[model samples]
Target: MKVRITIMPQAAVLDPAGVATAHALEHLGLHGVSSLRIGKLIELDIEGATEEELHQACRDLLSNPVMEDYCLEVIS
Candidate 1:
């Protein structure tokens, strides 16, 4: 099976990198983008792991629960 994990900062957390990227985009004349966020995408191919295991991996290793949120998807 193929899985995708997306990890991003929580809404209330300040994202310095995202803010910097947004500023850069404005400088390049790409206006009207009010907000931008930086996130991480992790793709994995596994043989027989259950969804629970994958979720545990995400919570423990892939993302910081204190500051980040995550979404897990089964691709195939």
Candidate 2:
């Protein structure tokens, strides 16, 4: 099975990297780019794991609950 994990900053957390990227885009003449939030995507292959198992793995190790949120999707 293939597992995709998207890790993003929480809504209440500050994203300085995203802010910097937005500013850079504006500097490069890329207008109309309002708010931008940066995150990470982790793709991996799991052998003999169910959807429930993947979700549990995400909650337990892949994401930080304090300032991060994650979503898991199976692609296979």
Candidate 3:
């Protein structure tokens, strides 16, 4: 099976990557860009687990619950 996962920093955390990207955009005359956040998109293939089980896997190992949040999707 194929799975897609998205991981992002939590709202309360400061994102240095996002800050730098927004600064660069401003310097490049990209107005109205507002802001941005950097996140990770992970695709993986696994065997011997159900959809719900995969979610648990994400909770247990794929993400840091305190500093980040994650979303899991089954692609195949």
Candidate 4:
């Protein structure tokens, strides 16, 4: 199966990179932006991992539970 994982910093966490990007966008004349955030995507092809195992990997290795949130999707 093919999977896509999206990971992002939790709202309560301060994201320096995201802030920088927002500033850059403002500089480029994109106005009226109320909020912005930065995140990452991971795509993988696996042989035999269960959904529960994938979620466990996300919690234990892919993302920091205290500071980040993640969503896993099976694409194919």
CA lDDT of each prediction against the hidden true structure: 0.96, 0.90, 0.89, 0.94
Candidates 1 and 3 compared: the better one by TM-score is 1
Instruction: State candidate 1's TM-score.
Output: 0.97
Clashing pairs in 3: none
In angstroms, how far off is 11's CA in candidate 4?
A: 0.7
Clashes of each: 0, 0, 0, 0
lDDT tens digits, residue span 22-62, model 4: 88989999987777889889999998999999999999999
The better candidate by TM-score, 1 or 2, is 1
Query: Model 3: per-residue lDDT, tens digit, 11-49?
Result: 998999999999999999997877699988889999888
Total backbone clashes of model 3?
0
Where does the lowest 10-residue lDDT sum fall in candidate 3?
54-63
Clashing pairs in 4: none
Which residue pairs clash within candidate 1? none
Q: Model 4 off-target regions past 4 Å?
A: none
How many clashing pairs does model 2 include? 0
TM-score of each: 0.97, 0.90, 0.87, 0.95
- Candidate 4 weakest ten by summed lDDT: 31-40
List CA RMSD, all candidates. Answer: 0.5, 1.1, 1.3, 0.7
Q: Which predicted model would earn the best lDDT? A: 1
TM-score of 2: 0.90
